[model samples]
Target: MSNKIKLTVLGLLITLNSLKAQQTSNKSYDVCIYGATSAGVVAAYTAAKYGKSVLLIEPGKHVGGMSSGGLGLTDIGNKYAISGIALDFYRRVGQHYGQFEQWIFEPHVAEDIFHTYLEKAKVPVLYQHRITAVKKQGNVITEILLESTGPRSVGRVKAKMFIDCSYEGDVMARAGVSYVVGREANTAYGETFNGVQLTNGHQLPDGIDPYKVKGDAKSGLLWGITKGQLAEKGSGDNKVQAYNFRICLSNDPKNRIPITKPAHYQPERYELLIRQMEKRTWKSLQDVFIWSRMPNQKTDINNRNGFSTDMIGMNWDYPDADYRKRQEIWSAHTDYTKGLLYFVGHDPRIPEHIRAEMNEWGYPKDEYMDNENWTHQLYVREARRMKGALVMTQHHCEGREMVQDGIGMAAYTMDSHNCERLVVNGMVKNEGNVEEGGFGPYPIAYRAITPKETEAANLLVPVCLSATHIAYGSIRMEPVFMVLGQSAALAAVKAIDGKSAVQEVDVAALQRQLKENPLADGSAPDVLIDNSDSFRVKVSGKWSVQKRGGYGPDYFLSDGHTDSSSFIRYYPDPNIKGRYEIYTYYAKLPERKAVTAVKVFDGKRLQEVVIKDEEVKVVGQTSGEWVKLGDYIFSGNGKPYVEITGNGEKVAADAVLLVAASK
Candidate 1:
């Protein structure tokens, strides 16, 4: 079906299924956070850390939005930009595995880590409670109506400060925040990467033309291509980023569950893919996801190769969708992706090699058991960007203009999913997943998290901030979300302290607090050292060490379907078991010259471990070092340690570089 028709049907279903319930509570609190995403969790925790009463309202059963959901692969651009609570989250993750962290890992590990944060903060999480009504008076929000799924489920509460951390900006929308959805024309932001373009830079299989009939205009458009009104390139439209479920796959014979045909699975749905394969234009497996953990016994399969299950150009209307309509959209995407998997695994039309490769992977029985082996969360990339006091545009990201009120920094290039589907010269083509190069990390403005001037006075939005389509793509990462979440909470507390709206919070003071708490950048007076690698760890004035390497193909695919260049490892050494000590402490630094030598000290003398460097290349992407450290060599009291005494005044001692592999 065409996108327009799918949107119309989904929109109508939303209208029909929508129901408004009555308000029942009148009590108020100090702070309120809407949408129980990772950002929401951070915001609430920050507010509570400041000794304020916080009420967290979630629209679903789960609290961690994309973080705990299927998106186990966290897209944290610049880790250094993430500080405060956000840094804490990854630190906790690293702690869980007793090793350096990566972007993509197991989903359950993410869930356990997030819940650990919530429990530590002692925040009240009201699940299965959707906000029914939001009332505002002048610059202040009076109260919000929340309806629960259980008996006596209706209640209302007022809050001095509110935050919208939802991916869709639902709370901000209900509170009357002005926002824009979909991509903006190039002229709108003077951004070269904003609008639709088929540069073939990130295209699916070459020669797999979009049009059905090759080089014949008379042949007409093919199936799934929307027939009505085509918006001009770079022009504004209701279109948004694509959404997909992160499939958790495994090759463990004991735990792997083969892809079973869904009850509604239809072979016809996959005919399009088969046609492409028949023409010898089948998609390659370069970017297929295979997440490796530290105790390397598990695997998390992700989109590694092109044409993987990212239902691109299909989720334009989801950000503002009502509950029921959202459900329908979710169902459609699930069916589409499931069918894709089934087609790849079972369809006889597929290449024997491709089918054999796919058959080797299946859902891990140990993960997401509650959802019948399906990921519980549908990865929502770009949603409603709540237009706030300051709109973070492409200019801010390109470093042409620095946000004075920097809460955090984003180092990733502006990355957007394939946003358009077109047939060029009778070949099927897709566009919009643009990737820019050479652009380092840029600071995120505090205003991006605040409510619109006309919206609620105290609410803060961290997850869905005020950014243009391309800009949001870069900022909408997990670590950045956590940083913004903490910043939002800090601002809320400051507002409550000063009796002012979030819009009116002092920028200078906010900056000071942010620096102290240091969510945006790790640059802080108290921090001893700060260094962060793109898509990895970030610390505050603290020195950290990472031993980076990729797992084997059974552990981490060098080439898959989702992203060929993505550094993913699915296996780690299991037989070599040993406990490594991790220490976090404040210390004074001694100035020195460049490094003379590197040594690992285990209390008395130097320690050693076997380091294996493997040259495994993932097609169409960068190669990674597959390093292995002997577990027996790095154990005991203060074991597997690195002693680096270089030049510096102070450095926050975060983690010891237990392992390091030169690529």
Candidate 2:
């Protein structure tokens, strides 16, 4: 009886006892959160902390969705923008590491933190309960029916507020809320990056054949290759972005479990990858496998390059698939990933050096012990996004528009993994990988997370909120999900207290509670200047506003071109003059220049500070949060201006903030 197994059994026992008790009582809770994801956990905790009785239901045996499943290396765009319960989770994670806060951590550590949150908040969580049906009266949900495997076979939870925090938006869809699956045409939302991106994206190596027989059109296409005429760029389609498992691996022999071929493994499935390897000379395993280090010796392994981990074009049926069908898809992805590991380590065609290096790394024995040393959750990148009153489009991400009723911020790039694999002009290519960044942080509108009042007034959706496929790409990060989850719970609590619909809650009141700050004069801090603000653009190239998920919106993107010089200048108010801390918000992209030159004219001298692209610490109070450049004295005269010039590298002049150091 290992301690891990004992603890898991005890937790299950507690959950069963709680479920049995609840079923008998038939007590209606103030809030009911489904999914048990990082968002769900935080939402449950937030609701409980605010004096609302919360019921956290999870379909799986484990919690924390991807964060604790195997994604140990957190994908936080700008750590500063994360606040409230989400930030508290990270701070607690840091405490476990004996530091103030830490982003990258071990999977078990994250799970422990989630458990601690549940215990401290006294939130009762029922595990392995799938939502069978939702009972509703008009637009308000009355109760949710739950089905379980063991002792407690069936249960129902009545709650005033229901939050669909599942990654798949299962409850949202089952409840008859209007939602969408697959990509939308670029024209649908006046977006440039939405829809069927067949060209100018993540493509396979040149000269690869898509047919089983070379130069023969009659010969059927190879396995995993879709057969069809490529759709026009930006055209709408039913295709979805790829999904993969964030497998946790380890090189330490003490904890390593060798990768084995899956039971349903078919060598022909990965024929494209073998062909790719044949054409290119291998450098190292790192060229194909992306291994990011966790706190322990374990690694968060992910797909890299064109032919990597993402199972492209295989998840198109996942969004609308039933539970049984979804399980099949999950199994397929697991087999593909496990088989890839085994093939890379043992295949004869692979280079000796690459094979040897891959063979050294294997699954961690201590992690995900019950799931055969593999993550139980599949990384469902994009699924059923709700079509609510407000839709977060690329325009919102590009800073062309801003949501006034903001619940949280998202700063990650508008990233979408490959969606389809096809043959283009005699070459096999992977399509739909949009990695556009340069926009700063942008606010996720409260309306986006809420369903239309006519659809469902009592239900709040955080994980599968309203957004286009491209915008959802940026909003899909785990941290941002947690942030939105907290906000959604807050909104649910407010609605329950006010006896109002989720959409009818005062936006300003919610913002005040979220900000959690008040001045001596009983006024909230003037958080000024988001990406939606108008700015003066000057240069040969055009400056566009872009939105980073988790962070607010940013302005001034050069579109990855260095030859075209551009400058974005901002003038502060004439009456506001003092020693102020200047912060520049931009995407922390890998291709960003090491040093970006910015000139500040303080009505006396024009000073230049070389700002580092990697500095993402929140310095002072402002709406747009990012790295601080430095503090400088600004004359009361309206002439004080700051200018950002694009000189090589991908320049992102998103937003600038000047906070008065002294009033």
Candidate 3:
């Protein structure tokens, strides 16, 4: 049958099935989610768990956006920031590997986990439903119209609340919610790394010629170099960070598809890479790409260095482009990436050692089996950021500004890929490559995810929350997106119960629910006392707070080389006096820095325990784990405490967990 006729038949079949399934024709739900991404699925699951009817609509066939797409080597800066459903997701993935949590995983494993969530939520997903328009009535989203794939089934989905979990904030934009694309000027948000940045000297090592012909300006620039004048430092413009495919390649020959010359391949397109390789002798093909190892001998290939996988300056029009134009951009990116890979592995002019190493990797035959074994989701690093109630800025990221109503925490560095490659001082340079990271995990405000009270009060945007360009870069990790997704869903439920708009929902109630019923179930969350919880963790002597690789927000590092007085004490503060299972977190410690003395006070006596490095094990990508510190009783007074005393060796303090002896 013709494609159009097939769609027509499919639509008729759907209508007939709906009529049979129920007598009344109903197209309404309590919650309407417009993306089946990692965030989208989590949001739908959360809404359904709250006893609300949820309709999850995906623009494509896949469910778990980039998390299951291929960015399997998670970009998590700190595990302590992850909470509730997001933490549960990692634990579920970990169970597959016979562990507690797994960050680096195969693409198929992540997708299977998402499918389990959908099945548990009892939410029916409408696949290939592209947003055509959003209908709103007086600042409230009444319904959204979508055109499904195969056939033009443009239909309306009415909902009490809407959550835009899509990477591109199409629903938010269509609902008249304000949003902005591209980097903001430093002055706009008072950020240090907001605008046109050239901090990293010409991306290509000095003397890499930009012209088509060596040293001939009249010959014109080669591929990938955009023709433009470099913008002044910290100035704003309509430029977005480069996007690429976080390809998953496998080395197992039995399950690998050989790297072949893809259609529309152009060898000359990678002339810059050839020139870059020539400037500095590369040891292996691995050095050219940010190839992080995954389970089952697979790899998550990311853009790294100059002239790698990131198709620079190619996706600037994506955030505002229509569906067809976006597809064209996606196809161009795919062609460029495929052509680059084929050229690197097959080009005889390249080093034999590099080609040999690259030959060992190819598309995994077991993954994306439905789509020619290739992932369909593009690694859209950043796109449209909703200009919501509060715009997160550098001040918040650096811990200089704190959010009183935080819904989630983001700890990754303020990172951005090269926004646009440029010709600078006669050498090809990359701009907007900023990787500033030093501050600890900062809370993402609830206001950051909600639409402004003036526009679409019922809509919540979690993936594309309110933030400046630099702030979004830090907050734009898959795990963090999942965190915000759960929080957004809870806020939606609370708004429905209160008969209020999303912005007017009680922030305190939402925060309390996030803590008391973290997983959206009545089950209680463990009482946590992280080092970042300054009010609960008391410290003495000199303690250095280090970011990254900690259990919670950040960890404390200190040594008694000068004085043995340094100590970090945690107060569990169990609401009632009772026996609780205690555990202390251990971050990846420095060499010869493992031994530490821990003391727990049970209101009667002080019990001491010594920690050994080899005793604790690592799980997933996080370099930290929780070790039991024994159960103890608190007196209901402030007498009970857990302290890691700084001894002769280096001491590290992360977090303390108090679990009620009962489940």
Backbone clash count, each prediction separately: 47, 21, 2
lDDT of 3 by residue, 516-569 (tens): 888786766778887768788899977788766677656888754635677889
Q: Write the per-residue lDDT of candidate 1 for residues 588-614, one digit (tens) a residue.
A: 122212221223444445644322112
In model 1, how many backbone clashes occur?
Answer: 47
Tens digits of per-residue lDDT for model 2, 373-418: 7887899988999999999999888778998998888877798988
Whole-model lDDT values for every prediction:
0.61, 0.78, 0.85
- The worst-scoring run of ten residues by lDDT in candidate 1 lies at 550-559
Cα RMSD of all models vs. native, in order, equals: 11.6, 7.3, 4.7
Q: In candidate 3, where is summed lDDT lowest over 10 consecutive residues?
A: 16-25
Model 2 score (lDDT): 0.78
- Candidate closest to the true structure, highest lDDT: 3
**Regions more than 4 Å wrong, model 3:** 1-25, 151-154, 532-549, 561-571, 574-582, 592-611, 615-623, 628-647, 659-663
